[model samples]
Target: MDSQIRSVLPKTDFNRRSFVVTSIAAGFALAVLPVGAATITTDTTGLVAGEVKIPVKGGEIPAYRALPVNGGNNLPVVLIVHEIFGVHEHIQDLCRRYAKLGYYAIAPDLYARQGDVKKLTSIQDIVTKVVSKTPDEQVLLDLDATVAYLAGKANTDKLAVTGFCWGGRIVWLYAAHNPKVKAAGAWYGRLVGDTDPNHPENPIDIASKLKVPVLGLYGGKDQGIPLASIEQMRRVLKEAGNPSEIVVYSQAEHGFNADYRPSYNPEAAKDAQQKLLAWFKKYGVA
Candidate 1:
């Protein structure tokens, strides 16, 4: 574990609220609120699904947690980092899907400290005012808090992480930050970008420091993330002797896994999900 991660972990378990976002946001993020018929909704009939609050420094952040109703503490943990849209229905559904597979999946609202992107109508505004303001340090601490919160409740030792879009970028950083993470699945996240005051590094920058193997799923046609960057990331990983792999779907575009969005690609999304499950099991995250 890194020194910073060591410092943020809860020294002792403390009492905390059950859930925060009691009622999930009505629909998809306002920026891309269009309702597509392909949206996938996972049920919670066999699992405990709903909001859960994670205690942080001075306050608490809300998260969606789903675990098997009968697994108790035997379930593996999968931290589902949400897209820039926040912990909306899609994210919660993902938690349920993981729970159905005997994994305790939790998706914390990483942007809680900055602002809620779900309510904002413009994607650019959400990026500028909310996502941009959220410090990487804060996001990492909140995730650590979430893991600490589930210390005794879930099989934390078999930990895996998966994130989409903006959260995809975080999957890389989290794997680098926490050595205990068994594996990570990053979906169409930017591999390289200009550094700012809050975010000083990209996935390419820390490829050499990654202790956890990352299964990076990308789309060659992704407009926001150029193919050159992905190639660069591959070069960095190889040079660093890292075993990470990046799989690019030549025909898919960014947000291909987002079932509710126009960019959603059912074929690619299904293949990626299967690949993710296999990757986790291969890396001992099961």
Candidate 2:
């Protein structure tokens, strides 16, 4: 951890007995072992970056926050929802990236109440034990709590949200849930899926109801998310007269922006990031 990171971290004894996943893990999750050679690491130089506690419903949840060292109050806020692997190194690095770009970025451990997925070695096991059991309502509430935590620290009115994988799906729901959000960038999130009590709606279900403009970045070759579903979402948005747009990278796969994964696509990731920033700026979130 950088000295700046240590300085900003809450001065509290974060032990396992006190909270689930008391602190952010050092590296990638066990499930994504053998870190890719292209893994990107963002240093906390000239930035206040580290772990902080977000007061939620039942209790507090651990969250990683990063922002400019000299940035005063009312900075633009960007909420980064994590992948199924949790808020590991990649997500932390992403926060730093946003901080470098003059945004107050935060990524809360939405799975803190359930279980730590970092220790789990298999993807399926993590999904069954942690992800599957997590309720969408709880996740949204936690996000609201996170924003509440920001109160005077950042400008909530200029709020923007972006997520990946599991978190990507959440970006859509959150936009519909919170009208204060100015813009959102969803990367490779599922558009359609079976409805259940925990997850009663997908992005497709709420396409027509979305008031906030959203930019959906999808991978054409993503096996998990079919192109047809993306088309359906686009149709719904268009029919509803929504300003949202979906862009597909024909050569990219899922997680193309995750530099620490095998699915990472440098070209696509770079372009998508540029588009996300432009989207945020276009919608007055910058």
**Best candidate, TM-score-wise?**
2
RMSD per prediction, one decimal?
Answer: 6.0, 7.6
CA lDDT for candidate 1: 0.83
lDDT of model 1 at residue 63? 87
What ranges in model 2 sit over 4 Å off?
1-19
lDDT of each: 0.83, 0.87
Report residue 82 deviation for candidate 1 (angstroms). Answer: 0.7
- Expressed as tens digits, the lDDT of each residue in 64-177 for candidate 2 is 999999998878999999988999999999999999999999999988877899999988878767777677888898899999999999999989999998998999999999
Q: How many clashes show up per model?
A: 2, 0
TM-score of each: 0.91, 0.93
In Å, residue 95's CA in model 2 sits off its true spot by 0.2
